[model samples]
Every structure is written in C-alpha cells, then in structure tokens.
Target: MRRNAQALFGLVILLAGIAAVVATRDWKIQTAMYPRVVGIPLVILAAIEVVLSLRGAPEGERQAVDTALSETLPPDVTARRTRVAFTWIVGFFLAIVLIGFPAAVPLFMLAYLRGQGRESWALSLVLAGVAWLAFELIFDRVLHLPFAEGLLLQILRR
Candidate 1:
C-alpha cells in the first residue's frame, strides 16, 4: 500500500514537471531557462523514484547515504520532526515569495544554520555571504536572468 502511494506521488510529480516543461516550449530561451533547467531534472528524478518504488526493494535493501529514522524514532518523535521540517520548508517558501531568491537564499541559510544547526555565528555569516555572492555573480551578472521582484518589493515601489 505504501509503495503504491509513493509510486503515485512520484508519478504526479513527474507529470507536473512534464507539463511545466511542455508549457514553456513556446517561450524564448531566456524566459524558459529556469523552468527547463529545473523541470528536466525533476521529471528524470521522479521517474527514477517511481521505478524504485514499483520495484519494492526490501526494507533492509534500501540504499540511502544517510541513516533512516523511520525504524529508530518513536512515532511521536517522528511526527514532531516532520512538522518542524515542514515548518522550515514553508517558512523558506514564504521568505522567497516575500523577499525574492537572491535575498532569501542567504537569509534562509543563515537562519537555518544558526537557529537549527547551532553553528558558530562567524561560520553562519561567512556561509551566507558566500551563498549571496555566488548567487549574484552567477545568476545576475553572468546569466542575466530576470528574477521576479517580490510582492513586498513590488508593493513598496508603487
């Protein structure tokens, strides 16, 4: 039952990626760059997931680089951790929507590193600075991608 559900989820994601890629076919190369870059990998990975899920590997045969928490953690602890993870995911999404990616990426990285990971302040600051610099240099300066202004920025400018 779980495997079937996982396969279904992967199929849905694969279909969504295909739709996005197809919808951008008429767009100019500059406009389609982001979607194509993201969508193609999304489709490919989701297909792989669906195939794996359908193959139904034994529980002990799962090949993960990291340890699995599902077997070790108590249900309540797992649920709590899942909630926290989703909270961070939603928070990051909201941050991006509110502030745009170039700003949100470093802010999210710093917040996650300091607040969740409890890294040294200096390390967090340096990592965040590097992330921001790389994003600006690669996407803005080199690729010249036009990122959408955040809703907050748009409203503030008007």
Candidate 2:
C-alpha cells in the first residue's frame, strides 16, 4: 500500500514536470532546461518507481508477510532531511532574489554543505568559495554569460 502510494506520487510529479516543460515551450531557456534535464530524469525515475511497486511476491510457497512485518522500519531521516533541505533551498532562492546570485550562491552552498553534508566548516567554506569562483569567474566572466543581475549587481554598479 505504501509503495503504491509512493508510485502514484512519483507519477503525479513526473506528469507535472512534463506539463510544465511543455507549457514553457515558448521560453527558450526554460524549454531547454526542463525537457532535457528535469523532465527526462523525472520520467525515468517515475517509471522505475512504478516498476518496483508493481513487482510483488511470486506465487508464494509461503508468504513472507510475517518476516516483512517483523523487520523494523528504517528511520525517516531521508524524508526529514529532504523537507529541511528544500526549506533552505527555497530560502536560498529568496536570498538570491534580494541579495543576488553572486552573494547568495556561496552562502547557500556553505549552509547546505555544513547543515546537510555535516562536513567541517573549513571544508564547506573552501568548497563554496571554489564553486563560486568556478561559476562566477570561469563560467560567467570568461564565457560571458548574460547571467541575471541580482541585488549584488546594483551595489557593484554604484
């Protein structure tokens, strides 16, 4: 029953992502980003989930229900972590909107690494800095991407 519910949920999300990609066809950036990157993975994952859910016990000589029921359920750590991570991620995006990507990206990365990865502070900060440098300097600056200017750009302009 739980597996069925999960499969159904995945199917819904998969369809929604596909619909979003289709609906945003007019926007070149969104179209390119969604169908190839997000949509494909969602569809593939949904399919795998559905397959797993549909596969049940073979013609049972003896049902394993007793054994399955006896086994302790795993901790809900993944679900809890997912919720927390998503909350922080949304907060990070909001910060980007107000503070700008240049500043927000590193802050978000560091927080995610430290809070989620449970890594040492020094390592998290160093990794975040490297990521910022790679993206801002190597990608945005060198490649000359017209990356969206955030609040940081306003300050830089002044």
Expressed as tens digits, the lDDT of each residue in 91-127 for candidate 2 is 9988888777778889889988998889999999999
Clashing pairs in 2: none
Instruction: Name the weakest run of 10 consecutive residues (lDDT summed) in model 1.
Output: 61-70
Q: Report lDDT (CA) for all predictions.
A: 0.90, 0.75
Please give the lDDT score at residue 21 for candidate 2: 61
Judge candidate 1 at residue 7 and give its lDDT.
90
Worst 10 residues of 2 by lDDT: 66-75
lDDT for model 1, on a 0 to 1 scale? 0.90
In terms of TM-score, which candidate is strongest?
A: 1
Candidate 1, residue 86: Cα displacement in angstroms equals 1.6
